[model samples]
Target: MSDRIIQSNKEELYASCIKRKMEGWRLAQICAVTINDGFEMSYTFVKDSDMDTLRICLKEDEPISSITQIYPCAFLQENEAAELFGVHIENITMDYKHKLYRIEADTPFKAKEDA
Candidate 1:
């Protein structure tokens, strides 16, 4: 099935997620990329065998609202993103407290340019 991706602003993140969930979309994955001055987060959802992604850009220290309230399965992926990319995810149902990884350096996946 074809995949659809939509860019979303921070202000619309929660509402967008809620709308998707109400439409029977399941959270598939949450991915993050370290950019020059920030991080780009993608929330992928699946429905009817098709995939949809919601993309949002955030500054290095920006805090993102956790979607666990809408998709409980998002806890792990959101924690991983927080630990590896240093994107602060707020109100996580079960936050790993940024301890998802035991690496020497925090935010190990963050690009040097963004660090």
Candidate 2:
């Protein structure tokens, strides 16, 4: 099946996840990549043979609503995004408060300061 991307915004993130869940899709993963302005975040959902992703862009340190309320397991990915890429996720059901990993540098995948 072809993979599709659903561009989403912070305000509609939670609802988007809920819709996917109701459609029998499961949360596959969440990832973040640093951009010139901030970060591009993607939440992947899969069901049967189809894969759809919800993508959003947020400024550094800007908070995005957590989908853990709909998908409790999202806590892990949300935490990873926060600690590894500086994507601020708010209201995680089981927030580790940035202690999910043992990395030394903060937001190592973030954009270079000298860039």
Candidate 3:
């Protein structure tokens, strides 16, 4: 099937992720919430049009995908996941640089911190 992309609300995205996982879709990339206040999650997959590309926006909870079982290459994506949204991946090998918050760690978020 051809690849299809869609934007989903926070709750819808989480549900979609679960639904896709049940269908055995592997997690591709997790682009952090650069413009969505860390509430949006971007995911890519190798599936049919009905389940190809999905964008989920999560409000308070950070969702995680155990794609390591499906694709070993997901490690990098997992790292990026943490680096972008500050979502912790369970049992996944991670370090400082991979932490999303640390990406801006060098730069203070407040004027006082910068001072």
Candidate 4:
């Protein structure tokens, strides 16, 4: 199926997730990328042969809500995004407390300050 994208915001994150779950969609993957000075993310869902992506953007330090309540499997990717990209995702079901990885840099994917 052709990929479809939905522009979303922080306020609509949870509600949209619940709606998708009720519509027989399952969380397929959570992906993220660094934007100019922030983050852009996609929460992909699947049902039968269809796929939909709910996308959102956020500032570098903006605290984003977690969807672990609706999709418990989301904690893994959510933690990875928060720990690596400094996405500030809060209320993760299985929060790794930024210890998901054993790397030296706190936010390795984030741009380093000029030393």
For residue 26, what is the lDDT in candidate 1? Answer: 86
Model 3 misses residue 64 by how many Å?
A: 2.5
Q: Indicate whether candidate 1 or candidate 3 has the larger TM-score.
A: 1
In candidate 4, what are the lDDT values of residues 1-115, reduced to their tens digit?
6678999998999999999999999999998899887989999999988898999998888888999999999999999998998888989999999999999988888766678
Per-residue lDDT over 1-115 for candidate 2, one digit per residue giving the tens place of the 0 to 100 score: 8699988888898888888889999999999999987999999999999999989999876889889999998899989998888888888998888888988997788787874
Better of 2 and 3 by TM-score: 2
Predicted model with the maximum lDDT: 4
Candidate closest to the true structure, highest TM-score: 4
- Model 3 scores a TM of 0.50
Candidate 4's C-alpha runs over 4 A off are none
lDDT of 1 at 89: 88
Model 2 Cα displacement at 78 (Å)? 0.6
lDDT of 2 at 21: 88
lDDT of each: 0.89, 0.89, 0.56, 0.91
Error of 2 at 112 (Å): 2.9
Report the C-alpha lDDT of model 1 over 1-108, residue by residue, as the tens digit.
979889987789899889989999889899999987899999999999799888999998888899999999999999999888888889999999987777889888
Q: For all candidates, what are the clash counts? A: 0, 0, 2, 0
Candidate 1 lDDT at 80 equals 95
Deviating ranges (above 4 Å) for candidate 3: 6-28, 35-37, 47-51, 60-63, 93-115
Q: In model 1, what lDDT does residue 91 have?
A: 95
